[model samples]
Target: MMKLYKKYQSLIKISFFIIIFLISNNCNSQNKYEILKSKIENISQNSTDNSKSSIEIIEFLSYMCHHCTAIENILNQWQSSIPADVILIKIPICSNKKSEVLQKLYLTINEINKPYLHCELFHMFAKEKKSITHIKDLNDWLISKNINVKEFLELYNSFYIQSKSNRANQLAKLCRIKGIPTFVVGGKYTTSPAIAGDEYECTINTINYLIEKIRKE
Candidate 1:
């Protein structure tokens, strides 16, 4: 009886060690972003577009959110490296005035197709330490950028900007976004680099993982 009990104990210990070893090895193969991707991809499926043909990357963000401001560089770099086939999207938050300002800023620059100017807006506001509380500030900044002040204002106050702002707010609600810098992959799942398993790395990894998963599907 004693010999049999010893054999059972040895077997249990070996099994436990084997399980631990496998998990450790797997962890070694994984990155933080990969973990976030795995969490989402495990529950992935086809939805809106009806075939799961492409991966949807939505950066749900607000300019007023300092953390989002900080991570903008990372997103910018990640976006540049991504291929053209991926459906990249940005939803500017519009829950309040600050968010509203940011969204309007987005549409205004987009309206003119001045992407370079669009890219500089955030740096102007966050890095240069400028206060963007009113139209004058934005107007002055645009003028400084050599953007036609009158034309910009005409669009700024136009019904188009208002409609776009409302749409942004509605889209945000639909996505269930309550914070800045939240990201949703494929519209079925949402997370933040801060709240997700990994911060910015999660965003990049989610893109990579979904790219692989979609290719497989």
Candidate 2:
């Protein structure tokens, strides 16, 4: 009889503990949801006054910037899947020193029909921490893929890369860009998607709201 009573007590104890555990799990999930909801609400409140802008959304990014890479890593797919009517552009951040290298790579990838190579380079540099800052490093990497190093040197110093890099630098200066992973809506107002929101979803929500606000006007 004592053994049966002890067994009953054990079962009751287990049941009580299970109920508490389930309740705690539910509370944790609810808290997480509330936190996300609050962040979305904050973004919705801080949306840009799009009634005054005329241009589309632009993402000012840099391959060497870790924060920009983080956002691009998470939001690039969602940004790409945006509709054709959505004017989304990526502008690389420029420096007097190494901006030309990025422009050359972008133009070369487009010209050579090797778009995937751009992604590979990003993965190599941003993810793999390779020394991609110098033009020679990029040339050597390209050479491994059977591209002629001389042609890369030619393109690197060509008017094509120089003019485009200059233009990119000018645009960066005009925008008063101070940091990577910045967003400019309609070319007038600048925002930080990460600072404007808590999660990637909130960041996107802010962007979509701005676009709609523009179209309604």
Candidate 3:
């Protein structure tokens, strides 16, 4: 009887340690993603005015930016699976001449259903080193893909696309955007790979954490 009681006590102690170990491991895993209040900041009201929805995410990026290209790749895999209530908007950083045209291209391309071309364009600029600095270059590139260059140009230069690009640029100013691939969540909080480190998944997880935080509010 004494031997059996001692064995039982030993088992109980082992089980307690196992439970403690599991809890500690779970906590560590959760801590891998964190929300840095210092990193997340609010933009100007004028920039956030149109974001009437409960949750709005604006990604400030430039086509020529390599980090933006990396974020774009990550987004392609994650975007389709995002929550329905969350709205994601891509705004180009028009800090340069090339960015101006690229932003317009983004707006124009978004109007169409060619989702594949989105990342392909990024690849062309980043990996292929293709300098699409003008409307004519963009037109020729579209032609090769069997897309109508005339229609694309008309839309690219249209009043509607221009208005969107103008609004995006204005909003970017509110976010105090000094870099590409910055993500503004709920038009108030911003995060990026720079803040979250090189882990793209962690960057997204941080965004998800913000989404949940906003939902609670």
RMSD of each: 10.0, 9.7, 7.9
Q: Lowest lDDT 10-mer window, candidate 3? A: 34-43
Whole-model lDDT, model 3? 0.75
Worst 10 residues of 2 by lDDT: 34-43
| Candidate 3 wrong stretches, greater than 4 Å | 1-53
The parts of candidate 1 lying over 4 Å away from their true place are: 1-53, 214-217
What tens digits encode model 2's per-residue C-alpha lDDT throughout 90-141?
6665664675467567665655677677667667768798856676677678
Question: Of 1 and 3, which scores higher on TM-score?
Answer: 3
**lDDT (C-alpha, whole model) for all candidates:** 0.67, 0.61, 0.75
**Model 3: C-alpha RMSD to truth?**
7.9
lDDT of 1: 0.67
TM-score of 1: 0.70
Candidate 3 positional error at 32, Å: 11
RMSD of 1: 10.0
Q: Write the per-residue lDDT of candidate 1 for residues 1-217, one digit (tens) a residue.
A: 9999999999999999999897554433134222232222211233554334556677777566677777787888888887655666676767667657768887788779887764566676677776677888887888788988998889988998888778767666766666768776664555566554435555566556656655665
Estimate TM-scores for all models. 0.70, 0.65, 0.73
- Please give, for residues 127-206, the per-residue lDDT of candidate 3 as tens digits: 99986887678768888899988788888888999888888887777667767688888765777777666557767877
